[model samples]
Target: MAAVPALPVSLSGRFKGSFAYFTIKDRLPQILTRVIDTLHRHKNEFFEEHGEKGVEAEKRAISFLSKLRNELQTDKPVTPLEDELPDAALWNQYLDYQRNLPNGNGEPSWFQSPWLYVECYMYRRIHAALAQNPPIDNFDVFKEGKAQNFFESQEAVIALCTYFQELLKNIKDLDEKQLQEELFKLLQVSLWGNKCDLSFSAGEDSSQKSSPLQSLENMVPYILVNDMEKVWSLLVNAKKNRTERSNVRVDIILDNAGFELVSDLVLADFLLSSKLADEVYFHGKSIPWYVSDTTKHDFNWTIKQLGSANHMWMSRCGINWEGNLKKGVWVFHDHMFWTLPHDFSSMSEVASDLYAELQKSNLLLFKGDLNYRKLTGDRKWEYSVPFHQALNKFHPAPLCSLRTLKSDTQVGLKPGQGEQIQASESEWMGELIFILRHLIELQ
Candidate 1:
């Protein structure tokens, strides 16, 4: 197994005034409060369904969550997960690993541990709280927020679907140059769609309000790294080199649910319609995650909502997506490996099956900030570090990350570019970046 990179220290809340600190100190507690409020607000609904047991379950869950919030605010030590789910033992083992790290800070706590590990641990604990409460074990505390995001982004969804449908009508008539341009446009639409992240805004309403297609040109300057040309070249060359019996598979590790999901779907549709890829695989979370990350439920719900919509173009697009899934032209997968707190570097050792599966793809597209952080190990790397090095020998295939910076860690930039932006803009981290890196030879 490859060693974890000894680069810089992992990004943690220990750095005062940093984004990690702000997230732990302010954003996280706000999210916890919202979860507690949601449980309390739904007490009457629980009573209607499961009667006394449901109401009792709801009360107990709320009490657990309230106590969880207090622990975080008080900087209490991170505790072991008690739920007997398949991943629970692993979670407890990870806690023990954190506690015994060389040069450790005694026991891992909310504000003193690695931001990625502790943040993930908090969500797992939230699940455990409800999981132990029986009648409510299956309930999703984040469901309401995810559904609201989908409903609120209706206008943007309609606009994107309409534009995509029109583009498909004449796709075959376009020249290679025109095809490349269209690919670039769709990729950017998917990239900027990341702005709808609810976690970034602390469970607030972060849906898209305007036309996503119209805003692409305006957002171009915000991309610190643009690798569209290389991505296009790689796809085109793969097509040229393929035999009639061979297939080019593209895997998209998805991100936020609402407008962002629609954007990713549109890009996948374009890939199939343009013959750039024969099949597209979408990977989502098995559990509710990061406030807005897509899960299997959210994926099917969005498709169903789109298919049953009143608008013609939107409904047609949804029906087409449904057909793609049925025909195996599109596939959706949720691996437990995604929800675990380990970095990609640990995948070969901890989740070898998933790592092997990714090795089959011709191209991998990882969407949003959290995926980017995982790709780069959520560490403090120098600005000009090469993209492949930041990956820490975790390459399974040629991959691209369509991420909008919403965190403190970023890599694969020019010498002074990251510093230049940081000095001038307090919110510079909230911009888009398109990165392509190939650490291993293509299969």
Candidate 2:
């Protein structure tokens, strides 16, 4: 078989005066300021937790974050990561790749490098700051916002949990068509959940403000390309094709916390209870990222929150979700590569272990915009570019990107459709959805 080629990574230069550039120059600095202020506000708590040493560490982290912000503002070249984390080497190696790109000058700067690289570097640099400060090293600077977002969506969380619990009780009695309808419904719920990201909202509230389950049907018109049938067919047909469908695995590349995380769990629970998947694995970030992207801490905290909520059905769902973990049917995994800025196409070369593990799954569902960006390589493709082309070499298994359009770059649109939407709707991109199907096919 021929080796698959990697897709082009979006450069900040190509899209100057675009969202990508604005993010690096203005928005990123604002985010860094919040992070620095967050550390300062927590200084007293750190001191209480780790004494004077913790206070000193907080100051150090703050100092490091402040400097990082300045570098972005001034277009300073991105330096090699100074961390002991195993993935730091992969990151630095990728930096070398960027530095050697056709550009004349050697060093990769925020304004000159791939948007994905520099954006991801921002988060890793944040971790490096805290990592350099021992006492507060393990503390997530974004935890408070995550917690607040989750609590703010309490009503939506309860409604969705209640719906899932009800579905579980009657799932056995549900006919194939009813099950399919519910599956598609929940999937759409999960898709819309992508909008609940704080990073896209610039550190403001972006939680689901209403009952997601109730509004699922009404949002159907917004899905520009719907291949829910293909996805469902992939699962059911895979069942028929197999001799025995015992170890069917579905990997969910998870997105945000709060209601978005809850939506993912609800979908996971449905997949399990409906027997669409026998085992489910969730991939989360290793560190705080994109404001609300799920970290291991966020993943575990969401389950615990659900398990201990005052609402009966939500609490029940949480306990059972946790039990799935105990029974080894549901698993949570965190890999440094997910947090890295590299395109998914580079996984085999950069994080072969993660790529190989993904190949074991029957299906992989990537949620939210950043994962979507990485999957599509965040490149400028013709609107009608085949989604598989955008995927490049990332066909590890049967995979579907269940993402809402948040970023400017998107693929898999029909001819002239992109131009039409660009003209008609100001926020047309975010308001639409598209799904393409590929199943366990490797070239």
Candidate 3:
């Protein structure tokens, strides 16, 4: 067994009362209830599609989800998955790893293990239950909520698409100054769009309040550590130093499903139309995850939804996006590795193929809080620890984590910056702090 590094910040600490504890105690069960509840409402549809056998599968799936909920609420042992997914063995192996921890009773329990591990395990367990039962195996319990959330961001979607239309129309006319301004604006839009995360609000639609592109100046003060200039330089240097702009590739490891997705698409569109990247690759989850992580369904659905919307600019944006896919300007990929619980630092060893594929990109953008956690290994590092050290040599390509703070694990702050931010304790308007690998700090 790999020597487990310093014990992670577990949800069930000695006293059993951190946010992680609260999540397992309250939030996670609530999410499962909604999953089962959605199944209940769709019971007849399952019967309609799969006959009596489908009905039986639906009942079994619901029961499994309910029982899963019970184990979490009561803090029972996390049952290792029994399945055929390639990564299933790895999951089971980690369960064994946790089982042998100093305080473990030769078993992994919900509240006692690393919060990130067990929390991720719950979702994979749900997938396993469904995979074992047919017809329902393809059903996403969260599909309804995801689609509704997408529609709910209609106004912001229109405004953003309209902004894309305006800026992209004059792309060739813009000088470097104008080009950087547009890229920076869209980066903030993509970063702040993360605030609308459904998982953070426990599946509620957190809509964009006003025009995302119009709000950047007001958002300046909220960014605690801005490495965007360095990011810009990387892109600019790649464009100038490379033989052709089209050779540069930008890979975005996406997050969320609603407005956040739209923001990512808009930025991707800019990268392509402005020639910052020859091709844009988007990575999404292969299964339902963290309530709102992008999956193949969510990615296709958002693009089709935008392309076919009633509004003009919105529809045009969608149509253009469709054309981009058809022409191969934008490529989409989903790897099982994404849904696995391993921190990115384990990428080269555990998911070497993905690690190698990422090396092809000129730059990689990891979006939102969960991705940020995986990037930093979710350790309880002293805030001033240099960011590269926290990455533990996970660099497959030059990368950036554009995340809003939603979890307790953070690093790369200047001296005392962490405590100062904690003392204010104010609800955020919205914020985006990009943590770079300090090893790549621009001279």
Best by TM-score: 1
Question: Least lDDT summed over 10 consecutive residues: which range in candidate 1?
Answer: 432-441
lDDT of 1 by residue, 93-138 (tens): 8899999999678899988899999899888888887889878788
Model 2 bad stretches (over 4 Å): 1-9, 103-106, 429-443
Rank order (by TM-score, best first): 1, 2, 3
Evaluation by lDDT, superior candidate among 1 and 2? 1
Using TM-score as the yardstick, the better of models 1 and 3 is 1
Candidate number with the higher lDDT (1 or 3): 1
Backbone clashes, candidate 2: 1
In lDDT terms, how accurate is model 2?
0.82
> What are the RMSDs of all candidates, in order?
2.1, 2.3, 3.1
Please give the lDDT score for candidate 1: 0.88
Alpha-carbon error at 52 in model 1, in Å? 0.6
Error of 2 at 49 (Å): 1.4
* lDDT of model 2 at position 28: 82
CA-lDDT, candidates in order: 0.88, 0.82, 0.80
Give the Å shift of residue 119 in candidate 2. 0.3
